[model samples]
Target: MNVFGMGLPEMALIMVIALLVFGPKKLPEIGRSLGKAIRGFQDASKEFENQFKLEAQQIEQGLNTPTPSESEKIAPKEVATAEVATAESNNHATTSSQQS
Candidate 1:
């Protein structure tokens, strides 16, 4: 079977070389460690992918929802009217005192 672009013959050659270099006694231990390493890497990658997706969803929701500033924009005219009325009253009081 194809694995990392290496066919059956290539896999066999690599196994033979490893066996010759490391010997039979140490090979099983090495294989077990290698399997554990690969499993850990896969778990970490999946965790990172899930975390990324969750953050992206949160960001999307934040963008879609309206903020306080956006709601304030709709009622600014009433605030402006109140400000104008207060200013006019202040101007009238000042003029009346000056005339007296």
Candidate 2:
């Protein structure tokens, strides 16, 4: 069996090494520490995920909230002129493409 892509032989070898180094009595204590470390990592990861999700939601909400730009506060005539200029440039591109 592969545990997180570790083959059975690899796992067995690791266990054997651990047994030799720690002995049976200390193995349980090491295992407990390992379990706690894994759990702590999982908890921290979850909290980080939750925080990112919260920030994303806040950003989505801000996008929906209308904030008037400087242009929006400007005169309508200026906006119309800008739109016409953009449309002319777009038309020019389209004509160039069609000719090609």
Candidate 3:
């Protein structure tokens, strides 16, 4: 059997080295901690992936949905024209008062 491109013999050599370095007493503790760390990392990665997907979906939905325009609620062109007319009227009134 192969694991991470390493054959059984390579795996045995690695295990033997680890056992010699750590001794049998501490090997199980080290293994437990390593397993826990891997599990935590996997969990974090999955959570991040899920969050990214959710955000992407939200962005896609936002892009697909049409936003309500001011023109839909109120006549934008009319409102703009009204504003311009009011400004012109105010300028005329000011000019007349200044001449008088």
Candidate 4:
């Protein structure tokens, strides 16, 4: 079997060296810790991928929705300004008639 681009013989040699460097008693503990670390990394990577996908979906939805044009955005403000100007002119006419 090839693992990390190493053939079976290379794997066997590395395993033998590891066993020699760390005795049989310590090997199981080291393997267990290594397994746990890999599991944790996998879990974290999955969570990050999920969050990224969720954010991308939200952005895509936002982009899909319609946005107001410049004129549409300005319309309500223009109407309100026109109403205010009319009210002010009416008030001035009333005051001038009262004074006359």
Among the numbered candidates, top lDDT falls to 4
lDDT of 4 at 79: 100
Cα deviation at 99, candidate 3, in Å, is: 38
Candidate 1, 1-100: lDDT as tens digits: 8999999999999999999999999999999999999999999999999999999999999999977786588679888899999999999999999999
TM-score of each: 0.71, 0.64, 0.66, 0.71
Candidate 2 TM-score over all chains jointly: 0.64
RMSD versus native structure for model 1 = 5.2
Worst 10 residues of 2 by lDDT: 68-77
TM-score (C-alpha, index-matched) for candidate 1: 0.71
Model 3 scores what on Cα lDDT? 0.96
lDDT of 2 at 8: 91
List where candidate 4 sits over 4 angstroms from the true fold: 76-100
Local accuracy of candidate 4 as per-residue lDDT tens digits, 17-91: 989999999999999999999999999999999999999999999999999999999999999999999999999
Residue pair clashes in candidate 3 = none
- Residues 1-100 of candidate 3 have per-residue lDDT tens digits of 9889999999999999999999999999999999999999999999999999999999999999998887776887788999999999999999999999
Candidate 4 residue-wise lDDT at 86: 100
lDDT of 2 by residue, 1-100 (tens): 7689999999999999999999999999999999999999999999999999999999999999999887777868797899999999999999999999
Model 1 lDDT-worst window of ten: 66-75
